[model samples]
Target: MINPFAPIGRGVLGVLAEIGRFTAFAARAAASCFAPPVFAGQLLRQCMAIGYYSLPVIGLTAVFIGAALALNIYVGGARFNAESFVPNIVVLGITRELGPVLAGLMLAGRVSAGIAAEIGTMRVTEQLDAMTTLSTDPFKFLIAPRVMAATITLPLLVVVADIIGVMGGYLVAVNSLDFNGATYLRNTFDFLENQDVILGLVKAAVFGFIIAAMGAYQGYNSSGGALGVGRATTNAVVGSIVLILALNYLITAFFVE
Candidate 1:
């Protein structure tokens, strides 16, 4: 007799096995991050690549998101004669949620895929093996630097995103919404607290770690050739986004209470 639940059980087992492997890889990567023989130059280069280079996209996205958020908040709040809450809500939304989440998602698509492709190509081409032969630990030289860079830079990016996001809301409110510039700024500042910003930055750090870790994990384990690299890249992006969203909710819940 054919069991209907067989396929479902196998799928569940497969997912659990994947989770276990990823958790093991993440542990090794975290340990390598703290181990000695730090590569300063590689770390700096990665910081530039992952953080500085990502600014334009993050800024552009944040600004537009903030503007749109303000518009929506205004429209929604107007029904309750609470349109004046737009500045407060916009600032709160940008600092506490949108800035970090949007930045993380953007980096998952951009930085995570780039890391996966680069490392996966190295893996398939035997470049990573050559490093092993040369007595240089690839984890220390490659993974650690990229991981450290992403972890350090993402919070900074979120800070910039928050600032730009607020400015975007301010511009829209003052110009299009007929709000007084001073009043909007005042409300935005008055309602926003340091704890909110801190929690968001903390989320950015975790998201950054997830982005780099997932990319490195997929690329490091990739096999075959071009097809493998392509698969790794896709997995890196998808895995990062899923982890970021899941962790975002968890972290928010932790901090909210």
Candidate 2:
């Protein structure tokens, strides 16, 4: 009774099972996002919790990153008497790449973990089910608002991070490294194009959506108990980070021309 088709059947079933689950969840979340008794208060709270609360961490990270980037660029560009390009490169790199990527990764670690743990706990305690029994659309009331808030707020955070990061670089260039402030700002503005800034903002928006969606998806689907919740939290952070990197490349490619 050794069946050669058994392995193939099992593999096929596994793929189908995952696809079905993913599709069902996506459909439900999407439907709830639009067909909602809009939870404005919940959404605002989430925006503040996920967005405003993250500013300190993002700002600190951006400052250090910008300073280091300036130093590196200065050193590298100095090698060939290309020191004049330092401000331009630093600004472009921080605004167009580092700002969005770092902000996204930071949020992924902070916000995603919180969302996953909170939602996973609600699920484990059967609170989500209780809401369901009460004729409440759990997806609309919880997941959609959080996701929408994150998608809207994360870009604003990145924008702020970009400004702070550039200022950090400017400080290094002006005070620590002894350069003219006026000259540095002039070079930064002159070298930076509108497209560069736009590209970064676009990247930020995509990263925001990815972070929220991944967190919501993993948390909403988590099962088991404490262990499952922990796993989902871990997955949310890891998944969001990976997706941020992958999407960055794709977006870069699109704008490369």
Candidate 3:
């Protein structure tokens, strides 16, 4: 007789095993972060790579998203004669939800993949082994800096995203939707609260940590050769995105409910 549940059981076990391994990796990285002869230069470089260089893409994305969101909300609100609520709703949506989530997803695709590819290539070339021989701790020198950089910089990125997104919505509303610029701006500020922005920033920080950690974890474990590096890159992006989305919901619920 075929054991129908065997595959399901195996899948569950595999997932659990991966989770366990990732948790252990994260713990080790965290320990190294605190015990480090801190690499300030590397951390600064990573911050620029992960945060500064990402601004253009993140800004472009935010602008388009905000514009599209305003258009959609305006169209929907027209049906109920609630068009006056557009500015308030757009700002609220951007700050409380869309800003952080979109920024995280973007970084997962860009930064996470890059980290994985770089580290995976090093691993394949036995560079990490050489580091060990040179008495340089890979976790402290490589992983900790990237992880700390992401965690610290993500919130800043999200803040910029929020501002740009709000501005995009304002532009759309005032220009395309026949809204008074002053009135729209006033409504946006009036309706937005500090807590809403705070929640999004918090989510950004968490998502940043997840992106870098997943990338480092996948790359550090990868073997084989080019194929392995490619696989690690894919896994890092996929894992970071999935975890970001899942955790976003949990954080939102915690804050809102």
Candidate 4:
């Protein structure tokens, strides 16, 4: 028989250590972000890589989610003659919840894996060592730009996702579900508040931070050459998704009331 308390204590200590490392890395990234001879070119490339390239996947996810959410709500709401709530449900679900969450997860997979692989490759090739030898701050030059680009671009992506998602729901409701387009539009506009949109943007920003930071942190701290880099990439993606879900709940509780 094993000691339950021993396992619990180890788990707690491991969590504390991870928290400590994460906090230190965040502080370093924040410092680098503010004090910069900014890498505008690199940042722009990252924006394109992270935002523009991600649109199709994000858009498709949002559209299907919006459609299915409409169907689900319509079916359930009709039980109480609440079919009119479809518009409200679509707008609220997309703008206030699914839009940010899905976008973050998608980007986490794309952006995080890219960051890890790129940085990991550099690490394997000793390019990072060269930068250190030249007195270049890898944290500032390598990590900061990615973090800032992700942090800025995610909100933009979320905005696009929100619009596309709502449009998707509208299409399905009007064409497939036999609802009037004008009434659907009016209900969507009337039911969703400014706070809903603003809250989503906020969540997007937080998710972005999580994605970039986790990727950078894992890649930067990676070990054991090729195998290690691969492991780091996998860990970064998984970690970002888990953290995004956890943060979503916290943010929802704060905003939903």
Off by over 4 Å in 3: none
**Cα RMSD, each candidate:** 0.7, 3.0, 0.8, 1.4
Q: What are the per-residue Cα lDDT tens digits for candidate 1 across 170-240?
A: 88998999999999999998999999999999999999999999999999999999999999999999999
Candidate 4 lands at a TM-score of: 0.96
| Winner by TM-score | 1
Clashes of 1: 0
Q: Which digits, one per residue and each the tens of the lDDT, describe model 3 over residues 1-257? A: 98999999999999999999998998888787788499999999999999999999999999998999999999999999999999998999999899999999999999999999999999999999999999999999999999999999999999999999999999999999999999999999999999999999999999999999999999999999999999999999999988999999999999988
Cα distance off (Å), candidate 1, residue 15: 0.8
On lDDT, the leading prediction is 1
Q: Which of 1 and 4 is the better model by TM-score?
A: 1
Local accuracy of candidate 4 as per-residue lDDT tens digits, 1-98: 98979989999999899979987997898789888678888888888888889989999998899888888988999999999899999999999899
Q: Weakest 10 consecutive residues, lDDT, candidate 2?
A: 18-27
Tell me the spans in candidate 4 whose CA falls farther than 4 Å from its real position: 1-4
Ranking by TM-score: 1, 3, 4, 2
For model 4 the local lDDT of residue 215 reads: 92
The sequence of per-residue lDDT tens digits that candidate 2 reaches over residues 99-188 is: 999999999999888888898899988999999999988888888888788778878998888889989999999987888999999998
TM-score of candidate 3 relative to the true fold: 0.98
Whose TM-score is higher: candidate 2's or candidate 3's?
Answer: 3
Model 1, position 122: C-alpha lDDT score? 98
The Cα local distance difference test for each model comes to: 0.95, 0.87, 0.94, 0.91
Give the local distance difference test score of model 3.
0.94
